[model samples]
Target: MSNQTEYAYKYIRERILDGTFKPTQKLIESQLSEMISVSRNTVKKALLKLERENLVSIENNKGATIKSFTLEEVKNYLEIREALEGIIARSAAQHIKDTEIDELEQLLLRMEHCMKQNQIDEYSKLNRLFHNILYNASRNIQATEMVSMIKTQLMRFHFRTLLIPGRNESSLNEHKMIFASLKNHDAAMAELAIKQHISNVRKTIENNYQYLL
Candidate 1:
């Protein structure tokens, strides 16, 4: 992609993942072009890309907005991840090597230190790295690509819940268990760990059931 498109994608993706642009918000081409310091065409390309990913929607009447997710959709997302990630972890265990194990260890250590020090930025980076290691090990490029996109969408909620009390610590411990299961090459245990991890995310907000309505 050209520099302009790259900038456009990065800007829009950040806003979408950070909840800076909420659902049903207009994505006025001219205003976005000005705000992102990109051309209107570039902004259009970015918006179209998001639309293809179901992260944005445009209509002739109401125009564009961030996609508002229903609770059913949220449940479906987790269910898919739970199923796919379990298989991914199982498949990954067969292919994971010593070098990959070392990389995972490094990521786990970073996560542990980041949690202890309360370094959200570093923690988040290591968090991504930890999962990337498993994704790569899954050895399914198509699934890897799709999972990355879904992961980005889930991150909006993940980061939000991180700000809630006790979430960070809980997240750290869950990851530690996942790392341990993977380290021992126990795919079934890893699968369960993945489910539990996602379940913890689902339980974060007491009133989140309202989102379904």
Candidate 2:
């Protein structure tokens, strides 16, 4: 990505994550440029890209704003995520080698360790690695692409939900079972395990009822 793109993605994504910017708040081009010390053109281009990815909405006459979703939309996104992720895990089992499997195991261990240490930052980074590896393993562009979109839309909910009390341990155990299924080459088990993981995520997000649609 270009420096402008990187700047915009990081700036906007973090604001969205931290709630510094509300969903309906306008993302003025000049304001972003001044805030990030980038040029107006760069901000405009970045907003365009985000819009293309469905992460934001730009009105030709009214400027851009963070995309707001309904509660049902969030649930629907998770339902789609569950189906796609399960399929990805199942397909990955056929192609994943032992070395790659070991690498994934190490990630689960790291995630477990991070939880014990309360290393939220490292945990989130490693979590990304786990999912990225799965996406690559699936070897299906369409499926991975859909998951990427689902993840992008759901990123805000992850921190609010996953980092909640008692959720980390639950996630760690779920990952272990999924890893075991993958290690054993049991496609059915792997699929079921992944679905369970995602279903729990849906629950976590749902439990945060104060979080609007």
Candidate 3:
């Protein structure tokens, strides 16, 4: 992609993931072009790319709007995510190196600090980094690719969920358990921990976020 298109894509995608762009908000090419200092055509290309990623809906006369999901669709995606995370956790337990364990430990400490400071946004970013490290440590490229794709689809929803009251602390506790299981090289424990963690997240979303559902 050209620099202009790349900049437009990143700027718009970031806003969507961070909730700055509300669901169903219109994407006006002229407005975005002015905001990002890119041409309207470049903004159009960025919208097309986001549409391909399932993040935007383009109508014949209505232009583009941020995509929203039904409750059932979110649930189905969560189920697939849970399954992929379970496999990744198990593989990480078997294949992770001592250095990777050390890195995870450090990340957990930072996350704990975030919890103490009530920094949900910072904690959410670190939480994603932790999971990315764990998945990559597994060294299963195909599995990694699949999980990454699903994660991209759910990133916005995941960010919204993390902002829920008390969810940051709860999610940090779950990550601690997952890290402990990985440190012990206990494959079954790691797998079960991840499965339970994701299951809890699903329950949390269903119970508290009726608007999202």
> Which lDDT tens digits does candidate 2 get at residues 1-213?
797778877787778756677777899888898899988888888888788877789988999999887778888999999999999999887777888898999999899899999988788788889878777777677998989888888777776665678988898898888888888888899899999999998888778747533
| TM-score pick, better of 1 and 2 | 2
RMSD of each: 2.5, 2.0, 1.6
- Candidate 3 C-alpha lDDT tens digits along 72-164: 777788899899889889999999999989999999999999889888778888998899889878967787788787777777778677767
In the range 1-213, model 1's lDDT, one tens digit per residue, is: 788887898888788887788766778999998998889899888887888888889787665788877766776776777677777777777678889889988888888888789888778878888888988888667766766777766667766666666888999899888878888888888888887887777666334544422
The CA lDDT at 73 in model 1 is 71
Best candidate (score: TM-score): 3
Model 1: weakest 10-residue lDDT segment is 204-213
Q: Tell me the TM-score of model 2.
A: 0.91
Ranking by TM-score: 3, 2, 1
- In candidate 2, the residue pairs with backbone N, CA or C atoms under 3 Å apart (3 or more residues apart, or in different chains) clash, namely 69-213, 70-213, 71-213
Point out where model 1 deviates above 4 Å: 205-213
Model 3 whole-model lDDT (C-alpha atoms): 0.87
For each candidate in turn, the TM-score is: 0.89, 0.91, 0.93
Clashes per candidate, residues 3 or more apart or on different chains: 0, 3, 0
